[model samples]
Target: MPQLKGIKILLVDDEPNILRFLEIGLQNEGFEVLTAQDGLSAITLVKQFQPHIVILDVMMPGMDGFEICRMLKKTENLAVIMLTAKEEVEDRVKGLNLGADDYMVKPFSFDELLARIHARIRNHFPNMWGEVVAGPFRIDDRRKEISYEDKVLELSPTEYELLKFMAINNGLVLSKAMILDKVWGYDFNGEENIVEVYIRSLREKLNDREHRLIRTLRGSGYRIDVQ
Candidate 1:
C-alpha cells in the first residue's frame, strides 16, 4: 500500500515450492523479488541485488538464517524479516536479538507476511527527514542512524526502531501495547515478552546503568527520559 512498486525484496527458502509461491505472490504485489535456496546463495544475491528487504528462511542446509541476518546487519539500511518453522519463543528472540526486523513462522499467511513487509518498510523509511535530539541522544532519520552522547550506538534493526519511536515521544509513558502497535505494527501476533526482550537489549546498548535514558514504569510501561 505504501508505494511498494520497485522496492527490491529477496526471498530465501530451501523449499522450491515455497520460493516459487512467494516470488509470484510478491511479484504480483509490484515488488521486485529475488530468490535464494540457501544461506550462502542468499548472501551472494544480497550483495548483487542490494535488496531493500530480505525475507529469510531459517533452518537452511548450510549457513542458517541467524548467521545470514548477522551478516546482513553489517550492511546499512537493509531490513530483514526471518521465516522459521519453529514456533519457539527462543527462536523468535534469537532472530530479533541477531538483528532481524521481524519473523514469521512457517505456514504463515501470505497476506499477513505482506502486511509485515509493508510495515517494516514504512518504519525503516519514515517520511520525516531530519535529526531528532533529546539530551545526548540523537536520531538521524536521513541516515537511519542513532547516536548517544556523540558516539554512534551499534543497534539492531528492531532496536533502532524501538529507540527511534521512544525518542520521538520522549518523556511519555508508552505501554507495551502501544509500543507493539507502533514499532512492531498493529497486526503483530507475537508474544508481548518480545517487547521486554528488546527493551533489555536497548538498555544494554544505551548503557542505561550510568545514563538511565530508558526508565521502566512498574504498572504502566517504559519511557525515554533524557535527563
Candidate 2:
C-alpha cells in the first residue's frame, strides 16, 4: 500500500502517559506528532506546528479540551478531533457543533484514529477536483487549488479545506460558533479567537478589498456569496 506521509498531528492532553502513547502510535503510522498538556500550551503548539489534525482531550485543568477545540475551529488553518472521555449524545453534539472533523471516546483504537484521519484527508482533497465556483473564486477539489479571477491564490492546506467547507455550505447562516465546531474540530470548548484569526489571514491572502468573498454576517458567523 502506498503510504500517507507528511500528516502533522497535534495531540493535546494533560496526561503524560496518554500523550506519549498517542504520539508513538501516530508516529508509527508515519505521521509527525506534537503534544500539549493544557489549552494554552495547545494553542501555542497549534501556532507552531500548524498541524493537519489535532486530537484533543475534553477534560483538563485551566482550559479544557472543549474550550481548546472551540478556539482552534476559529483559527485560520487548523483541523481537530475530539479524543475525549465524554460518551453521550450531548457531548457528541457539543463536539460536532464545535467543528470537529471526527470524535472518539477514550481507549479508541489507534487504527480507528488512523482510518478516520485518512478518510477526512481524502474527503477534503479528492482526486476528482470537483470544482466549486463562487464569483471570481474557483475551487478545484481534486488538486486542492483555489483561484480568483483566474489568478491562482496560494493557500495553506487548512485554508483550502476551510474555503471548500464554506463554499459547499454557501448561503447557510453558519455561526462563527458553528464554523468553529464543523471545520475546526469538536474538542474546542468556546474560544472564538482562532476563527477570527484565520478569517483575517484568509482575507489578507484573498485580498478582501478586491474579492471579499468571505462575508461577516452580523450576529452570525460568515458567508461567501457572489455580488
Candidate 3:
C-alpha cells in the first residue's frame, strides 16, 4: 500500500545526488516534494509552494541554510529541519536560534530523519498529524491504507489516490476537471472520461450502487456524501 497523505515537503541542497536520493525516498513515503539547489530558488519555491516542512542543508553557495531558515520562519508557518556535515554545538545552537525545529548531522539514518519529520509535524502542526477519519472511512496515511467501517478496502494505486482525494474533500462537489488534474497529473494527456471510469470502479468496490455515499450531481460532477 502506498502512503496517501498529501504532506508537502521542500528539500534544499546544492548536491544533485543528495537531492535525487532524498526526493525518491520521500516520494516513496508519500510526500509531495519540491527541490531547490540554491537559497534564492528555495525561497521562491517556499512562497509559491508553501510546503508544510523544509529539509535544509547548511552549506551552500550564495545564501546558506541558516540565513534561509531565518527568512523562512519570519514569514512562513512551517517547520524547518537543518542538515549539516559539522557536528559542532555552536552550529546546532545557531540553527535552533534561527527557528529550526530540528537538526540532523550528515550521514544520518533515513529512518531517523523520517522519525524526526513526524516528530516535527506532530510538534509544530499537531492538527495535521495521524489518520484522517470522516464518517465510516478511516484513512491511515502512515500505513497507506483506507478502511470502510473497520474493514480495509483493497484498492489499486489510482483508486486509492482518487478515494483519498474525495474523502479529504468530503462534502464538496468535485468536478471532473479538478479530479483529473489532481489524481492524474495535469500533464496527463488522457481523455476526461478517465475520471468517469475510475469513479465507476470506486463505486463498485465501495458498494455504492445506490449512490448514497458517492453521489453524481448530473452535469456538475461527483461528491462524497457520507451523511
Candidate 4:
C-alpha cells in the first residue's frame, strides 16, 4: 500500500521542473497528485480537482503566491500550504498569519516536508464520527471532550470542532475550506485567519502529542494521515 494513500494533492508552480520534482516525490510517497503551471490554472485545479491539500509556490507569474492564497482563503473552504524560495521570517510568519497550515523554504529536505505533512494529517484526523481512543488521548465528539489518561481536556469551541472533524475523517486530506465549511458552518463570516487560529489552539491543547497527523501539504490542503 502507498505510505500516504487516499489523499489528492494539487501541486502548483510556474516552473515545469519544480512541479515534476514535487509530483514525483509526493507520488513516491503514495499520493494522488494534479499539477498546474500558473495562478489561473492553480485556481482551476483547486476548484475542479478539489485536492485535499495544495502545494503552492509563491513566485508564479501573473497572479503570484500571496494573491492565490488570499483567493483560496476567501473562497471559504480551501486549505493551503505555501512554498517559498527564501527563508525570510516575515514570509513564514505571513503565511501562518494568513491561515496557511504550513510553509517551508526551498532547499529544505523532502523528509522535513513530509514530516510536517504527516503531522498535519494525524492532527486533523484522529477518529471517526467525532471520536477516537488511543491510550489516554480519549476524544469523544458527542460530548466534545478530550481526556488524557482519563483526565478531561478543556478545549475551546473551535478546538473542539477541529478535533471532532479530524476524528471523523480519520485519514482523509481535509482542505482549509472543507474544514471551515464543516466546523464553522457555511454561515461563518469570519476571515480565513479563523482556521489558523483554531489550528493553533488545537495544537496547543494537544501539546507534544503533535505528530504526523493533521499535516500540511504545501500548496495543497490539509490531510489526516498517519506516517
Candidate 5:
C-alpha cells in the first residue's frame, strides 16, 4: 500500500472513547489527525485545519452530523464520511443526499473504515495520493505518469500539471485565470491563450476530438467530466 503520510483527517464524535480510539489509530496510520467532540468545534477545526477528509458522527446533542455535513458541503472541498448508530437505509440515503461521500454504522470494522477512507480521499483529494484516480483517469505521482481509459498519455511537464489539476477538480468549472495560475505559476505573465494550446494538445491525445471529456464552457474556462 502507498503511504498516506501527509493527508489531514478530522474526526468528529461526541464519545470520548471512540474519538480517542480513532485518533490513535489514524495517527499510527500516518494521517495528521484531529478530533472534535461537537459540531461547533468541528466547524472551527475545519476552518483552521482545512483537513482533506472529515469523519463526522451523526447523533450529537446539538447540531447533529447531518446538519454539520450540510454546512460542511456548502463551503468545503473536503470529503465527509458519516458515522451513525442507526442502520436504517433512509438515514444513509439522507446522509448521502446531504453530500456525505460515505456512511458507516456503529460497531463497524476499523479495517473497513480505513479502506473506505483511502477510497474516498483517493477519489476526492487526488493530489494527496501517491496514485490518484479520477473517473477513468489515473495519475501516478511517483512515476509522473498518467493514463486515460488505461491508455498512457505522452505529455509534457506542463501538460501533465494541467491535466492533473483539471482531473482532481473533475466536475468543477475552472476559469482561464484559475487554470493559468495553477498550472503555470501564480506569477506567470504568459498569455491566457497558452491554455487553449495545451487543451487542444491534450484533447488530441485523449481522442477527445469532439471535446466530450473536456468541455469548453465558452465564456467560462473549462471542465473535465470523464464520468
Candidate 6:
C-alpha cells in the first residue's frame, strides 16, 4: 500500500510466464519493473538499472539465485527477495544467511509478494530523520550508521536492523517474537533461531571489552542498555 512510484524492481526468473506475471503485477502497483531471464542478465540489469529491490528465482540453469543474492548484497543498500519452488527450511535459511531480505516459495500470492516488497523497502529505508542516542551508543537513521562512543560498527543489513530496533527501544526488554516481527517483518516464516543468529552476529561486531551493549535475559529476550 506504500507509494511505490519510481521504485525500480528487477524480476529475475527463467520462466517467461512467471516474469511477465510479476512484471505486470508490480507495474500495476506503480513500480518500475525490469525483467531478466538468467543470472548473467540479472547481473547486467542490476548494474544498468540499479534497482532498489530484486525478486530472484532460485533454480536457474546457471548462476543460481543464491549466488546472485550474495553478489547483489555487496551493493550498499539494495534489497533482495528470493523465490524458490522448494519449501525447505534449509533453503530459506540459506537465502537469509546469504543476505536476502526475504524469500517466498512458488505459488505465493501476488498480494503477499507485494506486501513483502513494500515491507522490505520500508524497513531498509525508514522515514525517520536525525540520530537516536542511548547512553554511549548512537544510531543515525538518516545515515544508516551506528556508533559506539567514537567508533562506528561495520554491520550488515540484518545486523543493523536488529541493532537499530533495540537501540530505539533502549532499555526495554524485547521478546524474540517482537524483535523478529519488527526487524525481520511478519512475512518471515523462519524459526526463532534466526533471531539468535543475528544477535550473535551483532554481538561480535559490538564487541567491547569493558562494556556490553546488548544484554540477554534468561527466559526472556534481549535489551540494549549502554553504560
Q: Best lDDT goes to which candidate?
A: 5
Against the correct fold, how does model 5 do in TM-score?
A: 0.59
Lowest lDDT 10-residue stretch of candidate 1: 125-134
Between candidates 5 and 6, the lDDT winner: 5
Give the per-residue lDDT digits (tens) of candidate 3, residues 1-227.
22437689999999999999999999987789999999999999999999999999999999999999999999999999999999999999999999999999998988778768877776887557558676788987677789998999999989998998898667778999899898998898999999989999989989999989899999999999873
TM-score of each: 0.56, 0.54, 0.60, 0.54, 0.59, 0.56
Candidate 3 ranges with C-alpha deviation above 4 Å? 1-4, 130-149, 152-227
Which has the better TM-score: candidate 3, or candidate 4? 3
How much lDDT does each candidate structure score? 0.84, 0.76, 0.89, 0.72, 0.90, 0.82
Please, what are the lDDT tens digits per residue for candidate 1 over residues 1-227?
A: 22244578999999999999999988976789999998889989888998989999989888999999998998757899999889999999999999999989988998778778867876885542256565677778677799988999998888889988887566778999999999999999999999999999888877786546788889899988764
Each candidate structure's count of clashing pairs: 0, 22, 0, 36, 0, 0
List all candidate RMSDs to the true structure.
13.8, 15.8, 15.2, 13.1, 12.6, 13.0
Residue 95, model 4: lDDT of: 75
Residues 105-182 of candidate 5 have per-residue lDDT tens digits of 999987778878988976997667877677788888878899988988999999999998898677778899999988
Q: After superposition, how far is residue 177 of candidate 2 from its true place, in Å?
A: 40
Q: What is the lDDT of residue 168 in candidate 5?
A: 67
Shift of residue 106 alpha carbon in model 1, Å: 1.2
- For model 2, the stretches where C-alpha displacement exceeds 4 angstroms are 125-227
Preferred candidate (lDDT higher): 3 or 6: 3
lDDT of 5: 0.90
- Candidate 4: residue 73 Cα off by (Å): 1.6
The segments of candidate 4 whose C-alpha lies over 4 angstroms from its true place after superposition are: 76-78, 125-227
